[model samples]
Target: MAEVAAITEREIELISRFVVLLKDEQDALKRADPSVLQEIGAEKIGLAEQLNTLEADRRLALGITDDQNTREAMAGWLAQHPEESTAAVNWEKLLELSREAKQLHELNAGLVAMHLQLASDALTILTRQSEQHHALYGSDGQAAPVSGSRIVDSA
Candidate 1:
């Protein structure tokens, strides 16, 4: 029980850190800073892996198998050990933080998508303009106007 409580507390702390990182990521996305975003992405991945390990440890402490219903098992454990109110509160806070992190991740994805679309549109416009310009000019730096008129028809 004590181990479970301790693990829950650790999870809460880690999750709080994760939420802070998510906020940083959001700001980076807003600023469109590729280098900062890349760094934050790596850090987020590391924190996520650590959180997964902590979750497994917490489950093991509760004697809940992988196939078991984790939420139900946690609730049962909390019910049986009413003295661990701190753990229960921490668990709730962890859930809230997880939800917040997920939301931030989704928002960041949307921002990335928007940025990609804008780039694609700009590229398309530039390509079309280049093609139009090439159609009006030959490779020898001579104008090949499409109006079927030549400046030197016999030369």
Candidate 2:
């Protein structure tokens, strides 16, 4: 029980940090700072890995296997040990924070997708303009005659 509480506390702390990191990611995305985004992304990945390990540890401490429904297991454990109300409250808070983190992650994904789409569109436009410019001029740097027009020989 003590071990579970400690693991839950660590999970909460890591998740809180993750939430902050996600917000920073959103700001970085808004500013289009690739360096900051890259750094924050690395940090977020590390936090996620840590959280996953802590979750596994918590499950083990609670005698819950991977196939068990974690929520049900937690509720059963909490019911069996009413004296550990703090752990129950912490678990609920952790769940809420996890949801918040997920939402922020989704929002960041959308922002990144939008940025990529805009970049692709700009590239397409530039490529088309380059092609048209090339078509308008010959290799000798002279205007290329239009297909429907002819050079008029004057007297």
Candidate 3:
């Protein structure tokens, strides 16, 4: 039981750290700071790896072999120790923060996609301007349209 309590405490700490990292990533995205984003991304990956290991340990400790068994295992634990209400609270908070992190990640992905589209559009415009109507005399003295290098596929 003490070991179970310790696992729960560690999970809570890791979840809290993950939430902080998510916030940092959100800030970096909002500011459009590439350097900060790169640093935060690496940190986030490290945190994810740690979280995965912790989760695996937790599952083993709880005798849960699959994700579907997690709720059942936790419920059994909770039933065995109704006095440990803090564990339930911590679990709920972790779920909440995890959802928030997922939403923030989706938002960041949308922002990045938007930026890429803008860059591609700018490149297409530049290519068209430089290639269209810029005719060169061929061997038969005929005008031709220069092949434009497009960032986006026409197909």
Which candidate has the top score in lDDT?
A: 2
Candidate 1 deviant stretches above 4 angstroms:
133-155
Q: Which regions in candidate 2 have their CA more than 4 angstroms from the true location?
A: 133-155
Q: How well does candidate 2 match the true structure in TM-score terms?
A: 0.83
Ranking of predictions according to TM-score: 2, 1, 3
Between the candidate structures 2 and 3, which one is better when assessed by TM-score? 2
Candidate 2 lDDT for residue 33: 82
TM-score against native, each model: 0.81, 0.83, 0.76
Q: How would you encode candidate 2's per-residue C-alpha lDDT over 26-142 as one tens digit per residue?
A: 998899887888788899899999998998998888998999999899989989998897798899999999999999999999999999999999999989865654355556898
Give the winner by TM-score: 2
Instruction: Tell how far residue 19 is off in model 2, in angstroms.
Output: 0.5
| Model 2, residue 135: C-alpha shift (Å) | 7.0
Ranking by lDDT: 2, 1, 3
Q: What 10-residue stretch in candidate 3 is worst by lDDT?
A: 146-155
Show pairs that collide, candidate 2. none
In model 3, the clashing pairs are none
